[model samples]
Target: MYLADGLVPYTEVFSVLDWWKVAGTRYPTLRKVARDIFAIPVTTVASESAFSTSGRILSEHRSRLTPDMVEVLMCSQDWLRNKCKGEQIM
Candidate 1:
């Protein structure tokens, strides 16, 4: 049924969420999945900047650290930061 549906007109201000809401009855399973997927917050940060921790984590004194160790440190930092935020919210 979705495949046969016509595309939304360019002039119309159509929202994916709005369409899902109206079509929820027709596509209950898909509507649930779409809701969960769309619930994730959007990020505007560039991938390069978001993943690069080299400047902050790497310095002259820390240059000796292996790549594997650097990766572990980066993962630990992110986990701790997220854990702290979760604690504060509760």
Candidate 2:
């Protein structure tokens, strides 16, 4: 049913998020998934930074760290950075 619907005019909506917010009630399941997917904050960091960070984190001395540990470290680093920025803003 969703795919059959006509495309929304760009003039009527500011963004995909806005469109979802308005039309979501008609498709409850899809809306839930879309909400979860869109809730993630977008990052502006360059791709090079990710490569360099991973390289440093997985250096020979740290190569034995499990994939789960690597994920935890990356998420923790990002959370800490965001927290510090929020503190600085005040």
Model 1: which ten-residue window has the lowest total lDDT?
A: 81-90
Highest-TM-score candidate: 2
Q: Return the number of clashes found in candidate 1.
A: 0
TM-score of each: 0.41, 0.42
Return the clash pairs for model 1, or none.
none
Q: Which candidate is the best by lDDT?
A: 1
Our model 1 lands, by Cα RMSD against the true structure, at 14.8
| lDDT value for model 1 | 0.77
Compose the digit string of candidate 2's lDDT tens values, residues 23-51: 88887888988878878999987965764
Clashes of 2: 0
Off by over 4 Å in 2: 12-18, 50-90
